[model samples]
Each structure stands twice: as structure tokens, then as C-alpha cells.
Target: MAFWTYMLKCADGHFYVGHSDNLEARIAAHQSGTIGGYTHSRRPLELVWCETFGSREEALAAERQIKGWSRAKKRALIAGDWDLISELARCRSRG
Candidate 1:
């Protein structure tokens, strides 16, 4: 089965991170207000980014890692800014 880690660009201009095996259903749930919590408060979200994984464990790990990243970092990923990602990647390795 395939799993996916997604980033939603919320109405509030912030992003929400989540993982699911069924991306379509999950996004529908959020759009219809069937899901609650952070995303509920920021309704009408847009799918900003999504990466598929071969396993749920990989998806979950990516979700956790993304959730811990700075807002700028997350935005960079959403924007598909590989240049910025590369810069950030290098920064993390610097002492």
C-alpha cells in the first residue's frame, strides 16, 4: 500500500502537515469540516505539497520531521524551492 505525507496551505496562511494512505479522502474530510483541530480552525485548505512513500512508517517519519521544521523551511518545501532546501540542508550539517 502507498502512504503520503502532505502539506496543506491553510486559510490563515499557515500550513498543516498530515499523513494518509488515501489522499483524496483525507482532503475531502478536511474540506467538508469533518475533521477537527488545527486544520478545522483554518478551513478551505489547499494541497500545497505531497510526497508518496512505500510504507506508513516512512510517511509518518516524514510528517514528524516536517512538523518539527521551522515555518520558513516548511514554506520552502511547499514552494519546491530546492535551492533553499539545499541551503537549509547544508546549514544543518554545519557546526
Candidate 2:
């Protein structure tokens, strides 16, 4: 069984980070608003990024880490700008 850490770009232009064992089904639920939570009202989500993990714990950890990231860091991740992400992390740590 594969676990996944995913990020969604919501209709409101905000990002939602989560982990799931069933990425497709979970995304479908969020799209349909059946999950009923943060992404519920912010429907019409676009999957901006995702990564498969060996375990649920790994996926959950990734989700938690991403959830705590600044919007710029998140955008850098979505854009696959590793250098920028590193720079942002250093900036955050120095503050």
C-alpha cells in the first residue's frame, strides 16, 4: 500500500496539504465536497504537487511539515525550486 503527501491549490488561491493512502479517492472526495472540511468550501481544487511515501507515517510527516511552511515556500515547492526553498528555509530560521 502506498501513502501519499499531496498539496492542492484551492479555488480561493490557498493551498491545502494532506496525506492519504488513497490519493485518487481522497482527491475525488475533496472535489465532490463529500469530505466536508477546509477543502469542502474551497472546492474546485487543483492538485499542484504530490509525493509517494513508503509509509503512512512518512506521508503524515511530510504533510505536517508542508502545512507549517510559508506560502512562498509552498509556492517554491510547487514550482520545484529547490534552491529557493532552501533559501526560504534559511531566511525563516534566521528570523
Colliding residue pairs in candidate 1: none
Clashes of each: 0, 0
Q: Candidate 1 at 8: error in angstroms?
A: 0.3
Model 2 lDDT tens row, 36-62: 889999989999999999999999999
| Model 1 regions lying over 4 Å from their true place | 92-95
How well is each residue in 1-95 modelled by candidate 1, as lDDT tens digits? Answer: 99999999999998899999999999999998999898998989999999999999999999999998878788889889989987886887794
Report how far residue 41 has shifted in candidate 2, in Å.
0.7
Local distance difference test scores for all models: 0.93, 0.97
Give the number of colliding residue pairs in candidate 1. Answer: 0
Quote the positional error of residue 74 for candidate 1 in Å.
1.2
